[model samples]
Target: SSRYGEDLGKQDALGNLIRELARTDGIEWVRVMYTYPTHISDSFLDAIAAEPKAVNYLDMPLQHASQNVLKLMKRGGNRKSLERLIERVRERVPGIAVRTTFITGFPGETEEDFQELMSFIKNVEFDRVGVFTYSDEEGTPAYELPNKVPHRTAARRRTALMKEQSRISKRRNRKRIGEVVRVLFEGESKESELLWQGRMETQAPDIDGCVLINDVPEELLPAEGDFVNVEITEAHEYDLIGRIVLV
Candidate 1:
């Protein structure tokens, strides 16, 4: 919540919890969400990248890149600072999957601001991204602002942003083909047990796609909280198919 955002010191608690959970027996995956850009630090990135059990992924939502819109939303950071944080993550972690969220149609969001956001997205080349049209909550200052973007306009902008992200995601996923990725075996797919499900380091537990193994060894098929190596052979829309390399 915004309350925690007030103090950057509280940010370490979430990352610490992830480390604690990953050390647990039944905890095979530790995914972090709703991270704000301002709270990120050098230590947090180091811990996430070095942790063996934790998935090497971080989701920091920087709603808009424009300075005016950021101030209006009280996001607590500017565009330059956001870019530096993204660059820092890439520099510190070799294969880190940086996911982020965005918002469109905030009151007074201009065409220039939207273009700036698009440029930022293109430059970052994030592994995963999500976009949403602005929702005017009861207590938010945005709700009471004039020049509220129309629903259709907001939707069109959101679509444009998503289209950009979709292409980038497809390219990133395709690059993983033939790589031996460590997957946390979750369970059987709805289609059949022959089709087992799992996820690579870049993927979170539920939000991201899964690794679909067509056939599995009787002993290697995991119940849960299990880690195995899978060689990515194919990519689906949001999922992948892999052959077991280690169990």
Candidate 2:
């Protein structure tokens, strides 16, 4: 579920293989992660949108929106291209949850650049966002740079970005309330006597949050391959509290 690299060329073959597997008789869900912005083709996006078994979620790592930092990192795409790519994906697949990561505190990073990245995040309104303080690796150009930001400053930047994202996350999750969402049962809850744990369409295993199934009827509790319809009763910062709608 973790995609460490930024090259889509390395992932396209595997993506095709996964698509073929989705064509198999019983496969019902296929989720993809770690998409590179520059390498994602129109065909791939179309296929992803059209495939029923493929969940419309992509975890693309853009690192930073600042052109200078991106150039130093040797990343392929620019801000304009990133904007276009995002717009394309959303236009192709309505309601797709776009998840992303942004790196902070790169060498020579200006306050204006960080602010620009913040503005970009706000505009994109990503479903899930993660920010990492830049780690200087030996033999990397960034490591050899003279204008290294203080560790505290980097941490502060990371915190600030995530704080903004937290509000966005809460607002997005709130939109699901009162809507019927299909949930895949993961297990029974230990904390609450009548609560069972499950995940809705937007949630991935362990990374994103989950839905709590409370006060379920005897014949309507969740099981594997059984997608239970549940109405979102409450929305948390990262998860949902819901009761089975039994549709």
Best by lDDT: 2
Q: What are the clash counts of all predictions, listed in order?
A: 0, 0
Off by more than 4 A, model 2: 1-18, 189-194
lDDT of 1 by residue, 129-198 (tens): 8899987899867888887888788899999988988888778788879888777777777557568887
Candidate 2's error at 70, in angstroms? 0.6
lDDT of 1: 0.78
TM-score of 1: 0.86
Where does candidate 1 have its weakest 10-residue lDDT segment?
A: 1-10
Tell me how far candidate 2 lies from the true structure as C-alpha RMSD in angstroms. 3.2
Residue 101 alpha-carbon offset, candidate 1, angstroms:
0.7
| Pairs with steric clashes in candidate 2 | none
Give RMSD to native, each candidate: 3.0, 3.2
lDDT of 2: 0.80
What's the TM for model 2?
Answer: 0.89
